[model samples]
Target: MPAKTKTSFHKPATWSDVAPLLVDVAMGRQKADLVVRNGRWVNVHSGEIIPATDIAIAGGRFAYCGPDASHAIGEGTRVVDAAGRYLVPGLCDAHMHVESGMVTVTEFCRAVIPHGTTSMFIDPHEIANVLGLEGVRLMHDEATAQPVNVYVQMPSCVPSAPGLENAGAALGPKEVNEAMAWDNIIGLGEVMNFPGVAANDATMRGEIAATVAAGRTVGGHYASPDLGLPFHGYVAGGPEDDHEGTRAEDAIARVRQGMKAMLRLGSAWYDVASQVKAVTEQGLDPRNFILCTDDSHSGTLVKDGHMDRVVRHAIAQGLNPITAIQMATLNTAQHFRLERELGSIAPGRLADFLIVSDLAALTIDEVYGRGVRLARNGQLEIDIPAWSYPASARNTVKLGHRLAAKDFDIAAPKGTREARARVIGVIENQAPTRALEADLPVAKGIVGMDRRNDVCQIALVERHRGTGAVVNGFVSGFGYTQDCAMASTVAHDSHHMIVVGTNKQDMAAAANRLGQVGGGVIMFSKGKELALVEMPIAGLMSDERAEIVAEKAEKLTRAMRDMGCSLNNAYMQHSLLALVVIPELRISDVGIVDVTQFAKVDLFV
Candidate 1:
């Protein structure tokens, strides 16, 4: 009734209520709050750059956007001279996990604001796995309070793959319906349970029904490469947007099925190059393609850029500058059904825009959100209030006991000198891993890593429920040459502890060190600590500023390199080693999972 009584920093007033104020400002009956004059407006709606444009804003919404806005300018108005720079809509990230940046939502906003990302559609499922609905609520509140528009998508799949792994929390139809009523919720998050949806599972379908009934978009994750019946069946289940496509064919299929194809580029996921070809090579309408950074590392956010990086990559893939900007801006807004609210420089829309000095290289000179200058020349112009997570959200790294070096021992079958084991093969800059078979040596009843074969031991230590259970497996492709171990509590979907090491004692020390510090990633080498990034919030995000986290992340990557590991952003690959939903192979608290089969398999095959 009456639009469900929602109010937040993201949606402070309905356009109907603001229309009168806009009319007064545009007609010079009232002074505008802010004005940007003498610019070239990049009209996403018309697909043209009109020179000598002016825009007037009042009440955080654009009131006049035309050749001139001098009529609304008054002594109180804050006037910004664009000096003929291109006025572009503030970039939008259509799909992302804020926690993937390893920082809280406030810090994420602070980090990306200077790079021209004014809106983000974030999925809090990573937190939901650790703290359940309480965690989602915490992130939802924090996101709505930010200066930029951060819309929450109620996490659809918590455990991600039911019956495959253990998660700290679970969400069903009840949680979905409850979150739908939240003031800042934009839609349901990526339905990671693709198999369940394809199989017509009632619970999964019912979550989609609830979001549709609430009139919100449903995010999709068809991680499989198959475009046959299962893919069609999943689309029939009602997810209207997907960011999991890693190929041009994947993008074509998703768009053909009436879903917006989101090409993502993040710390490790280099998908935009392959999938944007759906538009650049296949001649599909570019409007159906959206750009996103599904999982940006903190270092990438600070050193590189956020959505700005994605747009640049898309342009490099041979898209016109306006077309590339549309993929990151207007197309994203249309996909989320928020076109009139943001994503374009037009009257009655939020005054979220960027001043750009170059169209092709896309250099952002200033960033604005809600008619307020947020950043200029790649620096924050205002203070973003710090947000604090409650104590319950902290201290989430629960190890049932102080893990001992002996606990990491993978004892081979008695009397076996060597063991033929299944190993997860890590491919550089990809989410999926390869299932390979390797022969490893065993000594004194324990299986040892084969550094000669580039194989190491991987363990999934149960953090949720703290059962003290450890699932052991072998993994390759890290190329470690010394006594080094790395452990992380930010395991995907389930948030378990993933430990990969060349030796047991170092692995044990890495795991125990995380237990001592609440939660985060730690690397140990030769009985010494190498790198640590403290993620105290639900074992997924740090409460500090993103710059600080970025610095820590840089040091962490350097440590990985020093350990002789040669993968691009190997920490991202390490964190996702336990994501049972992605295909080929993965490890979980139960055992190693053959994701293509979605079934648990033994280590020694």
Candidate 2:
């Protein structure tokens, strides 16, 4: 192997001037900082792969890309022997929540960077709902400190669904205005209150106005699948992109309405395949489609993959490889208006690229961020420090007292031997759950579980302010045969304690286990606590390193899989029990929310 040379070039006046800079770097007249030799460059810009190319980087940005080696190389430049690999741009997740990883922003970055995710558009809505504007700022500041690009999107729906469940703190239009002016804020977070937008609610309109005034993107979440008048009304509300689509038609409708359709593949949500078909088969313009992972837990990032998984799934859905990569990279960057700075591996863009053995397999042989090698062969070469959350974020699981089985008992209508109970059925690989009604036998004026119908017990323990209130209900779809239970204080948006179980004792044990560890996810089986992932910060995230959190999360996931539950990515479904926005039925500190109507409803009809 010959020694590589360094090269440098002045900023080009136009895209037409790039060829001269490429020649200068290749001739080594100007020293380049680093060189990657002999790779298949997947140019997402032109949708072509120029074979046997070399890439040069300087000042953390791509300085040159071509077939020659003489000009760009200098005495001190570092050379990476690509040895015939596919060079692809690092992925960018269009919309996501860092808190969903059960780790801090820094930890989440550490987990995903090695998997070739160099940028993300994150919404701190979960923390904003817990700690208010201060929480959003905290996450924003931390995100900026990372070496990779982690753009913040100001939370638009702090309460998620007003009047349905109360958040610890709320954000109004003023907060939105202030966040839009922040330096690293790319846009407004997901407008979760879609109904409010369609209804022309003043608060929702004000928030949108603030974002538009600041020239920032307004993210969307039209969770309802009904493409009726309400959907049209929401389209008129000015959201630039939407990731809530689950079907091909849903995606097509969004694009037709002038919204970027962000198809997603998260831990629990397998929505990309059904929706990406809109681009692959329906003749929809692929430029309007984006790829994202809305809520990937640490286990999914570490043990499986990050945006790489989404890209692979998209390709598996019959999309062209380059088109799928473009969705994860350039399309997302363009959506956030960061295309010039970070998307493609070209001049003036951040030098983030993945060296892969095969384009289709996406076997990342080496990963680079900010013009430096960060990981090689699926292992991190750099060490990222653990972040410290405030003491106020600790022990958020403040139930006033120890919980008992009686607290979980849902009483039937007076003097009735049987009553019609409202049940929430968990849907596999989807966010929308079913609203089921079942008649159950009564014992001591309390409705008993109808195991034949797969109805199990679900409880929401009030953690904020130590209310010690346990609102219990019934849920179906987890075919738990043994006396097993699972609990988590990492409930979405509100960070409350949610426990689901087939046995009362096990449910109590699971809830108590999380309480003992401040907060986290725990599973109890046959009187033994089987798994726990301790998230001590706000009862929503662990302060430990990402790898540590990821390891624990992997165990918890395996435990769920071993317990006779086969719903794909059930842990994510477990975390959303307190998400009051998405409808059908959900539990919160107030009680069960009939999400369809955005109101509190009695557990027993």
Candidate 3:
């Protein structure tokens, strides 16, 4: 009897099977799955520019890449004419969050695939804070089903900063260990509790130990600007990489201490240029650094590019084009320890690459994933099946009762004409805010917003537990000239409801509007609802398609601008007001957070 013949598609491909399959294709025993002829390959590993190469793929992995691949091709093999285009490795986001895009995992994937992003290491901590273990599972399950590589990092900090803010759900060391066992989980998410780690808090250390014991990476988030003992202590606590660095020194410190400095260029966080100077001008090793977009809104992802935009920005910041590409592709993959599988265009790596006409402009004309064409000409060519989130993942907003104007009223000191109040000042294009103090007038026994001073009232309404607990503080960033308010349930780290407005009535209307729509961003001006962007999933992610969501987000941004808020991506800035982790001031259901002091301070002084 003749021996049985092995065939492609007999089973799911693994690393062990790739070699044999490549050998079969190279020897002409089995046909190549796909072939790309005549392309200049961007060799990130060797830092060389090799031109006119043919690449053969077998079982979704690169079989051979050389001057010619005619022998590997058979009658049934698919061929892609590169037309002398540059075959760069698929872009990888080193650190990011799917929830930050205000879309579900599937939608976010759909939006970025055309931008040449193939691999993403996402931290679902935003949902983890809202729905806990269950929310994480939803993001994880959906991420695994996507066509692109979406690896989950178990959220290390649910509330982000312990004792600072209260989250709907909490994740402990046990939860961290359990998530590490997940099939797609790569490592621990950003350890935002820098204070906890620096102070040798048992919980933070236990979480780090659990991830390290599982042989996975521990992500970092040292948001503080202190590069002194506190920074060193946090580094000693075992975080493998950090994305919170804002200056060149921050990057130098992290890389010098054997940690990957992940410089981010999100819509609001312009941190890459300052940090990339560490390598470009200071002549540091570029391999130890990575580029990422920690928080990009859907509007930014749709209008601007994803990793491609980050790479271009790095290039504009004086990084060589190849070096910038390496930062986005190879450096990112190495930091996540996924280099062998998904970073480069090597023989054993997955056949994920981009065909670009212009390297400097990054004009991506085609994107191939696992040797199959996924997108072309800035549009997805393949179908990404819709993922329907369960009812448990929807309608998470639980305000309990309708909010009233009185809920946002700030009571002044008895019989006082004016009083000094602490204000959470929003900074444009940055995460940290100024903890400013303002002496404001009192009217009808209530403190009033000073529109002339840009001081608007900010409130954090409890949504997770339906506790009707509203923490009020003053903010002076959105220059509201009219009686308008903007409210959203997509507050970072805590995922509570944040309402900022010049008028108490408008603030109440905006907060109640989100409750009515399950959860989303709502803007009200002069007793009329101006715009609403619904995000029913965990009050954090929208179930809509990317284009629709982007349109709504644009309208929302326009509405904010119409209401006199001039900050770029003001909604993103607004949503982060409740992020008690970053300094210098923030709001939580507990009270106003003095992040610089790491304590809750009185709203009135």
Provide the TM-score for each candidate, comma-separated.
Answer: 0.97, 0.93, 0.97
94-199: candidate 3 lDDT, tens digit per residue: 8999888999998998899999999999999999998899989989998888778898999999888888889989899999999889998999999998999999
Cα error, residue 248 of model 1, in Å, equals 0.7
* 349-459 per-residue lDDT for model 2 (tens digits): 778899999888788888888787778888777766555777876767777888776777788899999988888889888887888989999998878998777888888
Better of 1 and 2 by TM-score: 1
Residue range 1-605, candidate 1, lDDT tens digits:
11221223445566788999999999999989999999999999989999999999999999999998999999999999999999999999999999999999999998999999999999999999999999999999998788889999999998899999879998999999999998899999999899999999989988999999999999999989999999999999999988888889999999998999999999999999999888888899989999999999999999999999999988998999999999999998988889889899998998899999998898999898898888888888777778899999998877889898888888898779999999999989999999999988888999888998899999999987778889888999999998999999999989899999997889999999998888899999988999999999999999888999999999999999999998999999999999998989999988889999999988885
lDDT rank, highest first? Answer: 1, 3, 2
Alpha-carbon local distance difference test for all models:
0.92, 0.84, 0.90
Candidates arranged by TM-score, highest first: 1, 3, 2
Span of ten consecutive residues with least summed lDDT in model 3: 3-12
Better of 2 and 3 by TM-score: 3
Off by over 4 Å in 1: 1-11
| Model 1 whole-model lDDT (C-alpha atoms) | 0.92
